[model samples]
Target: MIFYIAKRLGTGIVLALLVTLITFLLLASSFEDVARTILGPSATPETVTGIMQAKGWDRPVLVQYFDWLVHLLQGDLGVSVYTSLPVADSVVQRLGVTLSIIVPALILTAVIATALGVWAASRGGVADRIAQGVSLVGYLVPGLLLAIGLVVICAVQLKWLPATGFTPFSEDPAAWVRSITIPVIVLMIGGIANMAAQVRGRMIDELRRDYVRTLRTRGIPPRQIVLQHALRNAASPALTVMSLEFIQMFGAALIIENVFALPGYGSFAFNASLQGDIPVILGIAAFGVLLVVVVNLLTDLANGWLNPKARVR
Candidate 1:
């Protein structure tokens, strides 16, 4: 297991480095323009040149990259061009807000989806029909539409929750929950829909395998055969789908945050992009790549544990 984990970690590290390099190169293409944007239009050419030189933009590309990478390793993501705040600090603060909702939503998604899927596979009838209906609704209904409708019913009309704004958990835990409830629900629905379908399909296939029949013939408990053997085998694919869903949730969170007026990493990144704040943009890009690498690495580890055959390959 240690060896397996190490190999996955190594691969993730390499992928992260490659992604950061590519992202840096893309951002570097307009490096000078970033300085110009910072200095404003009225600044003279010499002033811009002076600013660039001070920032070491005059250095070789490789040198600048290495310097940036070193700073990143030191937890310094540079200062935002517009806000002049440390990118790392801003990202961490906003990321906390995003994760507050995303983590809970993901947990709910995993539990609910796994249960619905396993139930549908084990007892095909109304359970199967219900799971299928959920899958169809998840596929057809857009998250944004659901969020809007939820706000209208739950927040606007019903007044059960706040329509906009967020409260920090540290400040008021109950208020924080109320603020993120709609957003979490929106994210959870989409995730459950996608992962439940994947899990149900995988579970159904696993239960039909010859091993399952053999186990049944051997007088093994039905629950043990289904839960321990079949579900374990089926989990790898569902886990993979869940990891991908985690990434997709971040994308969807952008729109959901806007609707709820929650200040999160998505809203922060969006505003940074609009202002072309290169430092913040680059910082966000690096964070995104790192996130993907970490999620994939975790998924690989979980898959390997569930299916030892994966460790060999």
Candidate 2:
């Protein structure tokens, strides 16, 4: 187990470094850069050169990337040209905001998807049809449109919650949770739907195995057999799906963040892309690639935990 974790952690670090190198290359190649954006038409040649030299933009792209990668290793993400703040500091502040919505949403997604999926898998007739139909509704809807619909129902019609923005959890934990609940729900809706489908498919397939038939012939109670045996075996795929979905959710949350006016890394990345804030944009992209690599490696590790057969040292 220690060896497996060490191997995965090593792979994740190497992948993250590669992602940073690739992002720097892409950012440098782009026509619009922070120096160009900040300098605008009000620049003399010296001023332009000064801005480039100051940001190390005047250096060869490879040299700039090497310097930037060294700083990243030392936990320096540079300064945001727009905010006049350390980019790492901005990301740190915003991470809490993003997790305030994501963490609870993930819990809710797990519970809802597991229950609905198990129930769907157990039911074979009209009941299964009903559960499947609801999953379809969420799966087919676009995240932005669904967020808009949720706002209409909860904010406009029910007047149950505020439409947007964040409340700091430290100052008012209860209200902070309250402020984020609906957005979290909206954020998770599609994820839960997709998870339900994956879980249901895996559970049903597990139930069809020869061991399940043998248990049935031995007159094992249906509930015990399904809950203890079936769910354990079936959940392996669901765990994999859940981990990957989280990686996707963070990237996909950009549209949902803009729709709901949430100040998250997703929203920050979206705006950075539009303004061509190369450093911030590349930082966010590097973070996203790191997220994907970590999640995928963790998912591979999870397989050993979920299935007794794959417990490599």
Candidate 3:
């Protein structure tokens, strides 16, 4: 198991490095001056050249990439051109906002989706049909549209929750929760559908296994057999889907963050792109690639843990 995990970690590191290098190359090849982005076309050539020199954009691409890579290794992720804030600090400050909503939203999604999946898999008739219908509704609803609808219904029309923006937990915990509650709900629209599909597919497949029949023949309670035996055995596949869903949600969070005006890494990335802030854009891209790699690594580790056969193979 340890060897398997080590191998996965090694592969994940190599893949992440490759991603970072490719992103660097793509941005470097653009050859646009950062000063033009910041100062407009009226800016003098000397001013543009000076800004590029200050940014070390005149250096060899490979040298610049190596310098950036070294800084990343040393925990200095560059500075934001627009904000003048260290990229690492910027990422840290906003991480809590995303995590607060994502963590609870993940739990909510898992519980609700799992319940629906288990109920549908066990009932296998009208109940299953109803569950499928609900899942379809969730799947069809685009996250941004759902967020907009919620903003109007809860914040504008009913005057219950705040439509957008966030409050720091340190300032007012209640307000913090209140602000993110709807945004999290919006995030769960696609999450619930994806998780339900995973759970139902895995559970239904597990039910047909020989051990499931044996457990029933031995007079085991139906609920116990389904929940304890079948669910546990089916967990690997469900987890696989859950991991993919998490990656999808993270990517979607960019749009959802902008809609809700939340100060998260996703929102930061979106704003940076609009401003054509190369350093910030690259930093955001690197962070995103890192996040996905970590998630994938964790998923690989979990797979090994859940199914020992995977470790040996």
- Tens-digit lDDT string for candidate 2 (36-124): 66888786778777888777787788988888888887988787778777887777777667767877887788788988888988886
Write down the worst ten-residue block by lDDT for model 3.
29-38
lDDT tens readout by residue for model 1, 1-313: 8898898889888998888888777777777787788788787889888988987887887788888899999989899877789999898888888889899999999999999999999999999999999988988998889888998999889999998999999999999999989899999997998899998999999999999999999999989998899999999998889899889988887887787888998998888877878778878888887888889998998898888999986
Candidate maximizing lDDT: 1
TM-score list, all predictions = 0.95, 0.92, 0.94
* Model 1: residue 226 alpha-carbon error in angstroms: 1.8
- For residues 73-187, could you state the per-residue lDDT of candidate 3 as single tens digits? 8988888888888988787777667777887787788889999898899888997898888899998887778888888999999999998899999999999989998988987
Error of model 3, residue 40, in angstroms: 3.4
Error of 1 at 198 (Å): 0.9
Query: For candidate 2, which ten residues in a row score worst on lDDT?
Result: 28-37
**181: Cα error in model 1, Å:** 0.7
Candidates 2 and 3 compared: the better one by TM-score is 3
The regions of model 2 sitting more than 4 angstroms off are: 31-33, 311-313
Q: List RMSD in Å for every model shown.
A: 1.5, 2.1, 1.6
